[model samples]
Structure formats: C-alpha cells, structure tokens
Target: MTLQQRVNELVRACFAGIWIESHEHTDAIAELAGMCRDEQWRLVTWDIERGLRGPSGSPSEHDAGDPLAAVRAISSLADGETPAIVVLQNFHRFMQSAEIVQALAHAIHDGKQRRGFVVVLSPVVQLPVELEKLFVTVEHALPDRQQLLEVAAGIATEDDEMPEDAQLDAVLDAAAGLTRYEAEGAFSLSLVRDGVLAPSTIWELKTQAVQKSGLLSIHRGAETFDSLGGLDALKAFTRRAMMNRRSDGQAVRPRGVMLLSPPGCGKSEFCKCLGNEVGRPVLTLDVGSLMGSLVGQSEERTRQALQTVDAMAPCVLMIDEVEKAFAGSASGGVNDSGVSSRMMGTFLTWLNDHASDVFVVCTANDVQRLPPEFSRAERFDGVFFVDLPGREQKDAIWALYRQRYDIDLSETCPADDQWTGAEIKSCCRLAALLDVPLTQAATNVVPVAVTSAESIDRLRQWADGRCLSADTPGFFRKEVNSGKRRRRVTTKPSVN
Candidate 1:
C-alpha cells in the first residue's frame, strides 16, 4: 500500500506506535503531519528535552522532560474527548528505559479505548525486541516524478509557461531519486543558476543528489552498440528487449538479462554499451562496498543502493561480475556468518518485485559459480552463454584494438591462437608501446583457453547444443564438414 494509505489503515486499526523507515525525514514528517491534520486528529509533539506539546503550540506546565509526562499528555487528550496524534520526536533513545517501555505498552493498550495514538519519529531505526511487536513500520519513499514536477512548477514563478513534454520528462527524469526537500533545493538551485528551468541544470542537481548518498553514482559513460563487434544475436536480443516497452505500450517486463560467459568476452562491455544505445545513463553497483560492521547494516545499505537505482529508473544498473559478491552462499555456511545469504536474498527480492524502469544488467564469468536460482527463466529475459571468441570474432576484436591503440594491424595477421578479445586488445596496446608488431607482443601471452583447456572444453561441450553460438554458422559447420570428410576418407581407403 502507499504510505498515506498505510498510515490511515494503521490509525484505524488502533496501532499505537508507527515506525517509519525512510531517508526522506523532513518530507515524511510534513506529509504525516498534514495527514493527521486532515484526519482531524489532535496533534501533539515530543522530544527528549520536551516531553509533549499541545495543539496550541503551548508548553506544558510540567518539566516536559519525563517519559511519564508524555504518556500523561496522551491520556489528557483522551480526557478532553478529542482524538490525538502524539508525535514523539527522537524518542527512540528513551525506548531502552524499562519504565518507558512499560509506560508505552500501557499507553498503547489504554489508548485503544479512546481517540489517542502514538507516532514515533526518529532519523534512525533502533527497535528493541519488545517494541518490535508493538509498532507498525512503513517506508517513506523519496519524491517521485509527479512530486518532483510539482516542486519544479511551484518554483517557476517568472516563466509560468510549462516545460515541453519531452523537456519536462527530461527534467523529471533528472530530478528523480531525490527527496521532496532535496528536489525543492535543486529546483531553486536550477532557477538561480540558469534563471530558468533547463535540463542541464537538473542534471547538475542530480549529480549532487547521487553524491550525497555515496552508495550509487549517476554515471555518464557513453558506450555505443557499434563499439562492440560480433555477438549479433546478443546485440539483437538486447535491442529488442529495450524497445519492447516503447513499441507495445505495455508495462515493462519484470527482471533483466544476465550475461554469462568466460572472462574477457565483452560481457561487461556489452552491458556498458547498452546504456548508450538505449539513451539512458548507466549506474554501476559495487556489492563489496556495501558490507558494514553492525548487524543488518549491510542489508540496509543494499536497500539504500537499490533504492537509489530505482529512483533513477529507466536507466541501466550494471552489476559487473556479481558472482564475486554472492557465491556458494547456498551451502548456508558460516564463512561470513550468513551475511552473504541475507545480501543475496535482498537482491533477489528486488529483482523479482522491482516494477520501475531500472534495467538490470548482471554479468558473470562462471555460470557454475553463480546461484542456480539467479539464472532461472523470468528472472532474466535471457541467459546468454558467451563462449570463446571464434576466429572471425577475434579478427573484429583485433580491428577494434588496432583502432584503439593506433596500431598497424595490416602487418600483424591474426591466427588460431586462443586469445580472448581483452587479451587481444592488451596485446595490441603493449605492441604499440614496445615499438614491436602485434604478433610479437603475443609471444609471451597465454589465454584462458590454453591454461584451462580441459575446463574450456567441458564448458563448450555442455553448451554445444544447449546454448546459442555467438559466431556464424560457417565456423561451427566447419567442424561437422571436417568430421564427415575424415569418415569418408577412412571408409574409401578400406573399400579400395
């Protein structure tokens, strides 16, 4: 349910303490305060020093510093025959007190008989076991597109003319993922910087908003589809999936795609390039950076990061090599004391239920290492197995590297060496610096296929019929042709 509906329901259900978990503290308080006023509930305020304040903004004759006084104030509202909402600001600190605990429990039971309610407002969440069962928790979301637009419109006094549909969308898109107050600050900043609303100014403000989180950053890297060579099937699939929503006018599909294959096969690069093709910024999520010392803190951090990505919807969220983040946790071992499992669970839930336009692009090196549930159908649009770069793919890779490093590839011809695209690029780069031809640069280099030939062959054998080949039919067909030729040659010699 939406935050407002949830609060209304909680109040109607006679819930005494409502714990709102959110980063948009000011906006939440303002919205809840307004909601209380609309519901005709008498409003009361509280803090550590000030126990409670009445609707008149009048200080109590009591010292206003005791927890018991706050409970008594709630009781006083019931005696006056008026429904009351007691907003306890920063009262979470006093929750550990035994007397306060019993008092709150007693107040909740007592308030249900009358028009009295308790609202706990705290910047941080610190619920003890005893209060967990008593309080109802809800998350106060940051400002969405409509809300941001309203804020922007409110500040535009001089140029009352509304922004064009496309420009307005762009402005809202940039303003997304920011809280109401933050969006207001950004809107004001934009007006002051440019004297009018502009898309560029919104972007500058968005950068600030993302920087404030430090969990997720708004990336501006431009990687075009043309930059990637070969893998036409994968490219076509990506293009189709991205445009599916626009063409059919349907709600975008749930889940994203997982690109799995050997290392250095352009999985990460393909993910990066998709953002450019789709005309959306890319945000990279580094899972390792989320771990924390406190219990549940890591999960909270992950939620915050994903929330940021959701705020910046209609963008690519790239989790490069996610296997490193969640591997072998299914065994339920205590290596990290189940932190990995909790982290994985949090991510999986988001992947399944996330309805936003955030397109997740997760790349993994070893499918064996990845949790099986992650590769299941519907979780991702498709699971592409990127095999070793064939000879044709290698040629295209070489051309790209040659252009990248200004190398004269005409002098160095590619052969049947098992060099991946990344290795080939590295060879070319080294060749340029050493003043040697690209062929010589590869003399000391060994690719994964060579060092781990058995494993590569096993992967290839497993994928032979099950997975789609990235290379053209001509290359794979050659193996069949050669086998046929060998059978014919042996049979003919026996007949003769």
Candidate 2:
C-alpha cells in the first residue's frame, strides 16, 4: 500500500504518532495534503525554516520556526470532531534534544484524546528511545515501473524521443530503484544528450545512486558469460534458474548459491558477468562498510542495506568472501559484541524469507569459518565448488586473457600448473607490461594452489562429493592422480 493509504487507516485508528521513512518528502507531503483535503481534516506542516504552515500557508505565530513550540502547538489545532494532522518535516535532526523529546511525548499523549496526530517525516527512520513505542514506522518505497514509465513519458514529449513498447521495458527496468525526481532528471538528461530517452543515462545515474548508501555497490559493466572461460555447469544453472521475466502474478522465491573455491578462482568474475548474462544488474553487498560505531546502528544499517537489495529486484546480489564477512557470527560475536551475530541472523532470515527475485551469489575461499547452520538446505539451491581450472579449461582461460592482453597466438603458451583464471589473467597482464614471453612471466605468477596448498587441500577434501561441480553437471568427484612412470629403469633385478 502507498504511504498515504497506510497513514490514513492508522490515523483513523487513532495512531497518535507515525514515523514515515521517506527520501522524497515533497511528494509524500503533497500526497498527505491531498488526502487530508479530500477527507476534510485539519492539516499543518512544520519545519525548521517555515515553522508551521496551516490551511492558509501562513506561518504560525507560535514562535515561527521554533521546533518545540511547533510541536506543542499541535494540541491547539486539535478538536473533538475532525482529526488534525501535524507533520514535522526532518524531525530526526532535532530528536537529539531531551526537551523536544519531552515535548513530543507530551504532545503525542494529548494527541490521542483530542483526535490529533503527529507525523514525523525524514529520509531515515531514527526513532529515539523515548518515542520508540509510540511511533509506527512506515517506509516510502521507490517509484515502481509504471510510475517510472509515466515520468519517462512526461520528459520525452517528442514523438521519436520516447522508446517504443518493447524497448521501454529496458528503460523502466533501469529506473526501477530510482526516486521520481531522479527518474525525471535521468529521462531529461538522456533526451538532451542523445535526443532520445534511453536506459544508458538512467543506469549511469543508478550507479551513483547505489554508491551513496556505502552498503550496496552496483556493477553494470559490459561483462557477460562470454567473458568467462569455465564454469559451464554454473552458468547453465543460473541462466536457467534466474527468472529475468515473469509470466504471471504468482511470486517466485529467491534461489541463491554458495560458491566455495580457493583464491584466484572465477567466482567473483562469474558474479560480475552473471547479471549482464541474464539481463540484470549485479549488486555487490559490502559487509565491512555496514559496521557502525554506535550501538544498534550496525544492525540498522544491515536492515537498510537488505531493504535496498529487495527494492532492486530481479538482480544479482554478490557477497564476496562471505565466510570472513560474518566470522564473528560463528565465533559467538565475542569480538564485536554480537553485532556480527545479529547481522548474520538478519541476513539468514532474509535469505530464507525475502520474496524478491534476487539471485544471491556468495563466494568464499574458506568455508570453515562459516557456521554449520549456514550450509542448511532451502537457503540456497546448491553449494558449488569451483576448483582450479583443468587443462582444457586453462587453455580456454589462456585464450581469453591472451586476446584481452593482445598476446599473439603463434607463440606457444607456457606450461601452467594448477593456475586459476585470475593467475592466468595476471600472467598475461605481467607479460604485456614487462614485454616478456609467457614463459618468463609465468615464473613470477605463483598459483594459489602452491601458496595455499594445505588450505586448498583441506577445501578440496571437504567439497569432494559434498558440493556440486562448477565445471560438471552434478556432485564433484575428486580425481585420483596415479602419476605415470616416464621411463622405468631396469633396476627391478636389484629389488631386495
């Protein structure tokens, strides 16, 4: 339901205080004002600059611009019949004051008996401890597809400026998580720059929008499944599983995968490419940035970040090195005072319950750090093990990076032993940078198989027969080496 509808019912039920978490206050206030006018109710809005604006738009004399006086004046606008609404815009800025808290407490208590309601509107929901129980939090959602198309139509007025029906889906999809204001600006910018409204400008603006929260970072690169060399099984599964387009109203639950691999594997690269492969945006969830210095702030940020992920639906959510991200959760949070534990709980709940069509891709080098419960079924469709590239896979990876680095195919590539896609790319990059052959450059590139040998061995042993293979179609099976003797000497006669 819209914020206005929700607030209308809550106000009729005598909810004295309502906290609206909204980024677009102008639109929200306009909707609220129209609702109040239609219902023939008394409405007044207050802010630090305008103080209180009544039906006449005149500044109230109750200490014009004084927050405390404006809050206290809500009682004066109350009556026995028609309900009165007092909107405090950006009231969270003044919530730090104890006196204002006391005044608001008094006002809310009196508002119930007098048919007056206090609505706090802010970009964030930061309810103070004193008013937490009194206020009901409501989220103002981002513009939907239909609303975005309407905004697009308003901007691209010319006949040829607007995209056609089939192409307009991409434009609306690009503006999915944007505000109406942002959408208008994007549409106008696209029209002015390209002489046509397009999704390019909207996606460019969306990257900036997603980065502002310091939680989710969006990747809209040109990478696709063609960019990666291996992981055919993984690519096929995700391509077939992700519901990029829906058929009916029945909601499809989210299906995620847990990827376990040693460092330098194609896990991260696969995630970045999966979005473009499936016609969706790739959102990287940064867990470290979610931490906050104040109490409960970290958990709140976690909730907000997940909410954002939900809002940007039909997208890929990539959480890289997730085992280390929530390590404290498995350790019982003795490190960060259980903040990681709470964050983990919130994430696990969302992973199981979120109704949005977000394909979660979590990559981890070391899965042992994660809690045992995290591997439970129903949370993810499968746990895939991305092993080091085999001979044929390495050839493909080498060919990919060779073309990327402008290396000639005439010169035979050097021998690569247990090197990952990343190491191959690094080798090619170093060869190109140093003007050396692949053989000499390969000397400088030590594989993760060699560096983290023990850890890799343990991981390989753990994932063997227990996880699905990224290269194959089913559960991964460890291959027995059984090295062949080059040329056996005739020393069998001397066997003692």
Candidate 3:
C-alpha cells in the first residue's frame, strides 16, 4: 500500500503510535500533510532544527527542542471528534533518553482516548523497549518506475534532454533504489555531464551509494560469454530463463542457479559473464562482510544487504564460495553463537520468497558443506554441476588462453587430463610470464583435480544423478572405465 493509505488506516483505527522508517523526511512529511489535508485533520511537525510548527505556521506552546514536552503536547491538539497527528522528525535520536521514553509511552497510551497520534519519522527504527510494543513500524517505499520517470521528466524539461521508451527505461532502472532527493540530484547531474538524460551518470553516483553502505560492491568488467569457453548448456539455460517474459510483457525472472564444482572450474567466471551477456550489472555480495560484531547487528546487516540487492533489480547477485559464507548454519548455535544460522535463515527465506528480478548465482566449491535446504527446488531454478573440463572443452579453453597470453598455438600442449579451465589459463599465464614453453609451465602447476582428488571424486559421485550437467543437457553422469586391459605379444618367440 502507499504511505498515505497505510497512515490513513492506522489513524482511523486510532493507533496512537506510528513509526515511519524513511530516509526522505521531506517527501514523507509532504505525503503526511496531503493525507491530513484530505481527511480534514490537524497536522503538526517537529524537528530539532524547526522545533515544533503547525499547519498555520505557528509554534507549539511546549518548550522548544524538548522531546518530552513534544510528547505531552500531542494530546492538546486533538478533540473527541477530530483526529490530530504530530510528526516527530528524527525522533529516534531522542529515543535513548529515559525521560523521552517514558513520556512517549504515556502519550501513546493516552492518545487513543483523545484521538491523538504520535508519528515518529526517521531513517531507522530504534524504538526503546518501553515503546516497542506501542508503535507500529511502516516502511516508506522508494519511488517506483513511473514515479522515477516523473522525476526525470521534471528535471529534463527541454525537448532533446528527455529519453523515450527503452532509453527512458534504462534511466529509470538506474534510478530505481534512490530516494527522491538522490534521484533528483542524479537526474540533474546527468543533464550537466551528458547534455541529456542517460544512465551513465546515474550509474556513477549509484556506485558511490553502494560503497557507502559497505554491504554490496558493484562488479564492473568487460567480461562477456565470448571470453569464456565451454558451459554452453549452462549459458543457454540462463539466457532463456532470464529472457522469458510474462504474457503482459513483464519479465518472469528466474530465481537463480546453484553452481557446484571443484576449484578452477568456470563457475565464478561464468557468473560474471552471464551478467554482461544479459545486459545487467553484476552485484557481488560478500556474506562474510555482512557479519557484524554486535548482537542482532549481523541479522540487520544481512537484511539490509538483501534489501539493497532487491533495490538493484534487473541485475545479477553473485555470492562466491557460498559454502564458506554460511559455514556454521546447520550447527545449531554450537559454533559462533547461532549468528550464522540466523543469517542463513533470513537468506533462505528471501531466496524462496523474493519477487525481485535479481538472478542470484551462488558458486560453491564444496556443496557437501552447504545445507540441504539451500539446493531445494524453489530456492533455485536448477542445481548445476561443473565437472572437470572434457577433451573438447579443454581444447577450446587452451585455444582461448593461447590467444589471450600470446602463446604459440602451433606448439604442442602438455598432457591436460582432468585439468579445469582455470588451470589451463594459469599454464598460459605462467608460460608468458616466465618466458617458458607450455610444457615447461605445466610442471609448476598442480590441477585441483589432482590436489583434491578424493574430494573431487566424491563430488562427481554425488552429482552423478542429482545435478544438471553444466556442459550437456540432462542429469550429469560420471564416466566409468571398463577393466579390460591390452596385452602385448612377443613376435619372435610366439609367446602369445
């Protein structure tokens, strides 16, 4: 529901305390003012800078800048028939004081009888224990596509400055998560730099916004599907799934895919390339980075990070080495005091229920360590197994790396059985850096298939019938060698 509708319902129900979590205070106040005006109710606004002011441009009778007095004065503006709403801007700043807390608690309790309401408007919800039960928290949503279009149009008044259709859609997508003020600034800045409304400047400013949160980092690179070799099946599946739209022309976004593979496979590279292939920005989410030192902080950070990911929709969210990120989720709090478990729960819920256009690509070297619930049907569109590169795949990988590192393609390649794409790249890099032949560089590299032989074998065995093949269609099947051996006969003695 819109902010005005929610607030109107709560006010009509005589909910004494309403907490609005919003970063755009001015926009929120303007909305509240409109709602009050429509309902013919009295509206008063309070802030540290403005003290307390009514619609008539008059100050309240209470002492200036005193939160306790503000709370007590809320009842004076209301009558038995008419309702009054006193908006407390940044009131969370004063929620720490015992006096303010007690006064708020009393005001909320007495407000219902007098048809008076105390609305706390702040960017974050920091209600004290005393008033926690009394206040109902609501989020003021970030502007949607239509609203953002209006914002862009408002700034770009000139005929040539405005974009239309697809170009306009791109601009709105870039401005999706920004608040009203930020969007206005971004639109204005776009006009200043590009002489027209475009996505470049908005994206530049968006990078700064993401950096400030310290939760998500934007992945900017020129890596595309052509840069990587193999994974044709995986690539085709993702492209088709992501491009599928509803009958109404809306995108029917795929949930995501869980990539299970040994080290050196192209899981991480494929994820990055997928973003470029689909024309979406890749957002790298570091789950370890979201863990906070204080209690409840980790969960809050997880929620915020996920929310940010949702805001940056029509994008890819890549979580590398996801197994290590939620290592102790299944330990039942025996390790790390249940922080990992709670965070995992929040993530799992979102994975299953989120309706955003984000395509989550989680790469894990060891799926054995991941919780079973993580790979369930609805959590991801598919669970794909990226085994060691086959002969054809290895040949393509070798050719690509050869060109990339300026290696001589005519030279003989070393024996690369069980080698992955990464190992091949490493061989080429080492050959170029050391000015050695590919065969010589091979001696310095030990493929993960050999280093982690037992683990890789176990993984292949588990995925044999369970996971989809990253290279080919249908379920993955481990190739088994027949036991027949070839025998050599001596011709001279006819020993055979």
Best by TM-score: 2
Model 1 Cα lDDT, one tens digit per residue, 1-496: 5677788888887787788776565566666667777887767777766466665557754445676677666766664355677877777778878888878877777787876787777756777777778787777777778778788888887664447689778888877887777777877877788777777777787887777766666677666877888777678877777876664577565356777667888888887888888778788888887888988788888988898888888788889888888874666637888988889989998898888888888887656666678767667776666766766777787788789889865675545466788888778888888988867887756788788777766665554444444443211211224643521111111233
Per-model TM-score, in order, reads 0.86, 0.93, 0.92
lDDT of 2 at 223: 95
Q: Write the per-residue lDDT of candidate 3 for residues 1-496, one digit (tens) a residue.
A: 9999999999998899999988898899899999989999989999887788987657866655777778878877778678989999999888878988988888888899988899999877777778879999998988877888888889999999999889988898888778789999999999999999889899899888887888888876889989888888899999899887788888666899999999989998998899889989999888878988867889988988888788779899999999999989866656899999999999999998998889999999888888888899889999998988887889999999999999988989999977889989999999999999999999999989788999998998898788888888777777676576422111111235
Ten contiguous residues minimizing lDDT sum, candidate 3? 486-495
Clash-forming residue pairs, model 1: 51-64
lDDT of 2 by residue, 56-79 (tens): 678755554788888888888898
Q: Which whole-number lDDT from 0 to 100 does residue 289 have in model 1?
A: 79
**After superposition, candidate 3 runs with Cα above 4 Å error:** 56-58, 245-251, 483-496
lDDT of the candidates, in the order given? 0.73, 0.87, 0.87
Q: Look at candidate 3 and tell me the lDDT of residue 317.
A: 95
Task: Between candidates 1 and 2, name the one with more favorable lDDT.
Answer: 2
Clashes of each: 1, 0, 0
